[model samples]
Target: MVETSHIYYGTIVHTLSVKNLEIIQQAVLVVSNGIIVKLDRNVKDIDAYISSASCTNYVLHRLGEHEFLIPGLVDTHAHAPQYVFAGSGMDLPLMDWLNTYTFPSESKFKDEQYAQDAYAKTVHRFLRNGTTTCSWFATIHLAACKRLVDTIHDLGQRAYVGKVNMDQNSPDYYVEASTQASLDDTRLFIDYTKAKAGHDRLITPVVTPRFAVSCSTPLMRGLADLAKEYRLPIQSHLCENPDEIKFACSLFPDCKNYTDIYQQHGLLGPDTYMAHCVHMTDDEINLLATTQTGVAHCANSNFSLQSGVCDVQRLLSHGIKVGLGTDVAGGFSPSILDAIRSGFWASKMKKVIERDMHGNSDYVCLQPSELLFLATLGGAQVLGLQDLIGNFVEGKAFDALWIDADRGNVDLIGDLTIFQKLEKFLFNGSADNILHVYVQGRRVSGVPDDENDLASSGDTLNHGVALDHTTKPSI
Candidate 1:
């Protein structure tokens, strides 16, 4: 068993809302059994606070002057197999890109060893970049998908893993045998994930339908029924590009629009989230708000793939939940920090276009705190994990990253305020600035004890235990 209680004296930064950022300087935080138990601001005596907790054997970590804790990033969309080709295939658009680069590359995952190596590197890279939670899209191969789950479990990262489902429009070599086979394999994948880590709620299996263009009507309906039956979250692509939207509407003529295709199949609900609604109609936005479904704003992928810029402000104004996603391979980056930068640019580009073309001079750009909220709490609301891991609250889990603003790529020369330091880290920092990454009190990644090296030796020393391997949840 591992030590269950930990205390830290440092500066704590978290978002109170989209535009409001709360920074507590010289605070004491108490985390026991992976949950934050106490947070006292303006703490003058760390020793007195520790005594008040009545803890003698608990570990107390002190933060440096340049270091502060922020909530871990939540990636709403990413592809596990595609991380191998993240920087490649940027020249092609959505449909041709999928045919040439995506399908062929994903098909190679039929080899279990290839999937294992690729998934390990991908998950490790995300954790190293301080992404504690992710929603991953695996290939159609069930065994390879299961291996992806095993990798995340072994690495001690929180994630929602989905075995991609594509039966109708995919290539012959990569597609499932039939609609029935697709549904059966999806059921099997859900059962495996639940039986493995159901109690911990760390790793969950999501129902993925690939997209409307790739899945048949019968297959989509079946997947929706499975989601309802298992009470699992559903994720898929929606109205990303003009060509993609055109094709999806053509596929289902009976439906009114691209969003209606999924809605007609009983897939739109509070538990479902669709990625890249770049070309959504006003009616469709209203439909999403009515159904309480969320959207994952993948600005990096959209910009790289030549997809249109998504108006996140419009979505937020309409009461639709929104979050950030580093749609790797399509996005060309795995870091949610990169996502935040790209998303900010995407919003500004939209504002500029509106001002120049539509004679709208009052368009507003997204603020830094708004972008931060999209990366953290907004993502939590998207994946239904808001109450557990979004912010630094008394009852929330301690999922956070220790960022050193004075570290590599970010040189703090003069004295700066607390918010100024945060802005520097957000705009100018890289992975080198992340000193330590923690998920549920487990240090998944961090800087090495030796200044010249990384924390490689102890990276896997204390991983979150799988419920399938142990009778009780490991603390």
Candidate 2:
């Protein structure tokens, strides 16, 4: 029989698609070397299967009745540097907010020690919130960006970290020096990240141009070329606010609209993802779909900063991929769960507005399964990690969160249906309810390390040693 590393038996919940929430009860999942090998359900005799497989050197973790395993949440867009001021500075529009708070806070990252201190907190907070994968925007300072990459790597979280590029804009205190300097620093940052990652794709570098408003035409073109040269994915903002849009268009009068500017610069492609396409026209949406560029719907940021509400339903109807983004300081939270809640409210707000306009509730509301998909599978598709994550398919990496619905934030007062339990967790659950967070089959976050967990489990882990540096006890 094959020697497996670990086997988990319990209820498993995950999205099969945007509309399908598959729940498997009494399931046995096999993992070897951090990759799922097999998932068997409704086993009549657990002992028989284990003996038949001749499984030796395996850790059997059994979940409680109130506990279930779900795919880890994915955050498609966020600014790691902006996390320092996440809860403050929400009384202004996009452009004003950037100048007043965002720019000044990001500029301080030029100090290496400060970057390290702030970045550690940001990454740890996201991990505790069950975000196994995140696509992060680091400041333009090359050294600070490199420090962000190192912090994520050490924490064992899967991520796409980008060194922001901006060669033009109003603020002289925070903008890049020139197009050449931005391109050179970006190349160095990309090379540094690639070398640091070695054989592991856990951390990747993205080309971030901030937005067309701040980036020069030459800088945008150079970034497009750099993305092609490195075969890396690109991320940036698009049509987030009205004033920002007008200014962006004024900067490039030859272009028809905001989306056209990106397409003209060879910046729109399948390998690229844009955030907050709240004000995109039908023609622009078509351009994105034609180019196969993914969109990150940052509902929390939209609501917090008073940016226009994005119709995620519209994006999906147009066959354009959509994902959830916290957008950090603008969103006022680092948790993807907050993104899910904000997205739900935004969809409901759309329904209300439509009813007010037409006297009937014809707007579609996002179902729980769909919200789960947006937070997980949809984000994976946006990051081009659909093949590796977003679900519990065989031969895929084991990135998951163990949900204890009966503890912490959620309360099981009486007999409830499985769907009710799931809904409660989605609406009310917090990090306290996530008993364990695993990335690539390794426990990256969970309960605190204690003597009980360090105790010998079996032949595999022994002598009160930890599973790894990032591993914590899950009870």
Candidate 3:
């Protein structure tokens, strides 16, 4: 009745919280502009309700027999430039990997055309893989970082783009000139991103100090100030590997430990999220909890880089927010679904390691529903976007994925439930299964466009064609 713009009739699955996964079948979701206005479940007759409400002038997307809608995957931590070398550099550790593959690959973004080409492909891959929201770590090259922002803006995936800050310990070929230089470039990057991102929801500028190892004290302090002044989110790596932690501790001798370095510099807060906190001490964990910082649990990267297993259960027990990350190149995938599957196995590995240490494990194995939450709402919480795009709550942006199992790589057998189908898609289904990727009510990715999507007069559907008023909503 409020002048809906789009109507979806199908099953919708999403997590209300960590343990509250909801599956609403035979539902009708209405979108006005880009926000979800109504979600009525168990609609006995969609056509009757449409006529009763007199809802006209809208596009209709009715799911097929084997289709369903899901909240799009949220990738809390990823390196946009590193996506060029995503499946490489696994043999080396974090510190060495940065030098061998990460730095060299990222440094190439200094070329603007190279950056755009790489970023376009990277953003497209993430979108087609159903990562509608991603917190991206772009290189320190200011122009390249700006290019990354423009590419994501043009592509339409919500993102947090950070021009990485590192004034010391980086290779001569890639490191910033000086602390002031790093700060100056970072200020420019933030300002540029803000100017480019006229609105607050789509693209946010983030403060990214690659890690304590590469950042100097003054540089860290300056970056923190920028975050406070702009009210932007902060992201960085922390306690990811033993050797890396050792180097960071050696750099800050006065601090109690590696985590204290950030706390001492005003870099840890609710607006901050650190990736791969695998080797954190109890005190460090407590510090994050007290600071209300979030953690991006990158299990595949941790295992690939020989970084220790992160006890997500331990982090959750302390009430520290946690989400999943691909940590591309190190983890070797851009697909958040891969992150989900890897997260599942990583949690199981934690259970084994805990049992081996304590003889009897009290660790709660991360359930499928909980892992699903980590990929969606939990990741949104990490990026400080929980109220915006995580789930199908009223007034939230409609970032979603349309799953077409029949069109995908799945070979469905007899009588499988929708929930079961989702599990299979999570563990076994590829990007082919995700037929459509939507962000803020706009179709951003997937296979060829649907001919049935009929837009109305005075409506601006990004990819939908306008239809006449006589064209009624059809099944």
List, residue by residue over 315-340, the lDDT tens digit for candidate 3: 99999999899988788999998998
Off by over 4 Å in 1: 1-4, 448-475
Count of residue pairs whose backbone atoms collide, per candidate: 0, 0, 0
lDDT of 1 by residue, 1-475 (tens): 5544566778989987787888999987878767898888998876665555543446666777888899999999999999999998899899999999999999999999999999999998999888999999999999999999999988879999999999888899999998899999999999999887767778999999999998998999999999999999999999999999999898899999999999999999999999999998899999999999999999999999999899999999999999899998899999999999999999899989988998876778898888889999999999999999878989999999888898888989898988899989999988888877888877778765432233333221211211111222211
Weakest ten-residue segment in model 1 by summed lDDT? 462-471
Q: Give stretches of model 3 more than 4 Å off.
A: 1-4, 448-475
RMSD to the true structure for each prediction, in A, is: 5.0, 4.2, 3.4
Worst 10 residues of 3 by lDDT: 451-460
Q: In model 2, what is the error at residue 345, expressed in angstroms?
A: 0.5
TM-score of each: 0.94, 0.94, 0.94
User: What's the CA RMSD of model 1 in angstroms?
Assistant: 5.0
Where model 2 places Cα greater than 4 Å from the true spot, the runs are 1-4, 449-475
lDDT of 3 at 343: 90
Which pairs of residues clash in candidate 3, taking residues 3 or more apart in a chain or in different chains? none
